[model samples]
Target: MSIIAFSIAKIYSDSALNDENTFEETEKKFDKINNNDGIFEYKSDGFYLKQNKTREYIKWIEIESVIYFDYHILKNVNSTGIEISTSHKIYKIHNNDERSMGIEKFENELNKNINKNELYDSEVLSDGSSKTPLYIKSKI
Candidate 1:
């Protein structure tokens, strides 16, 4: 009975968990990032991340890694996050945060801009709370 329940949950999660954003959607978000009015802003050279009221500019060459993953905040609310690691600092961007640029757009740009030293992809089931653990970490 538990196996059957797990199968059903896996199927449901596979169908419901979608994190990819269309190019059009990401392009529209590009406008916002270009406007330079948010927690995250994009530039041709790199990007700016605003944290604690201070804006820090991160150059593409300084990035060591980028990890993309999905996570759930509640039963039905699922979101994605992008974690960028530099030599001395780690920055995180959450899709659900209103103050930030859309994570999808940032991620898409990251793919185009940076060269990462190490790439890894995996699913991390935060807190062991999610039954299906739908999120996967991709090098995106």
Candidate 2:
């Protein structure tokens, strides 16, 4: 059973879980990482997304990739995040939209314990994609 915790209620099955709009809102709302109100201790068994607060598990196999990134345009609300893309939804976790030094910490936490060979190492995936030690698409 796949469960997504949008709140204390609103749990959906994995088969019924890909509503783009809802996921987008969930992403945008939870973009920043604040200890009092954000995701932490993220881990996977190569198949699920486990973290705090929600206690909902997103299967990783359902995810196409996790694009961890940080960018700013004219310092307009500095945005830094990991875009979790699945076959039908995108979940954004903006690590530090309010600050400048937290992106690195967010990233380090994101890649913690995951092997280097398990994710997309290059900034861009070439026309010829390289295979990861683990068959999952995660780029940093």
Candidate 3:
């Protein structure tokens, strides 16, 4: 167990996950959590989620899990923001109501893509366990 000097979340522009190949050319932005790619799409080949143009292609199959947490604040949150948990790291995505892009829209799209890809939503157990491909709501 050494140490990870830079393990911050990679922000996307939503376009990073348009359909799949449509976003292969999307430049992966980095630099102290710069908001880059939008939305998140899974390509048969791979997807980009980093802060570098040279190395940000991530294979879809490589993704072991995806946790969507958009419950920030009803008013404070500009539309919506979510964190995608992957095997490597967590990616941060923020969207606003501009251009008809809001939290509700993004959330629905995210779910559609997940189901289309045949992914399994993990469930976070009360014992502190975890899982999701679908979506786990509040715990009470």
lDDT of each: 0.64, 0.47, 0.43
1 or 2, which is superior by lDDT? Answer: 1
Summarize candidate 1's per-residue lDDT along 3-54 as a digit string, tens digits.
9998887677656655445444566666766554456677889888887678
> Model 1's lDDT to the true fold?
0.64
Once fitted onto the true fold, the runs of candidate 2 whose alpha carbons sit more than 4 angstroms away are 1-56, 97-140
lDDT for model 3, please.
0.43
Q: What is the full ranking by lDDT, best candidate first?
A: 1, 2, 3
RMSD, one per candidate, in order: 11.8, 18.3, 19.0
Question: Each prediction's TM-score against the native?
Answer: 0.53, 0.37, 0.35
Which one wins on lDDT?
A: 1
RMSD of 2: 18.3
lDDT of 3 by residue, 9-119 (tens): 122433445643333334432221233223333355655443323335555454444454334343354223455555676655554433222334445544544434455
- The true-versus-predicted C-alpha distance at residue 48 of model 1, in Å, is 1.3
lDDT of 3 at 47: 53
Clashing pairs in 2: 31-94, 47-60
- Give the Å shift of residue 78 in candidate 1: 3.6
Query: Order of candidates by TM-score, top first?
Result: 1, 2, 3
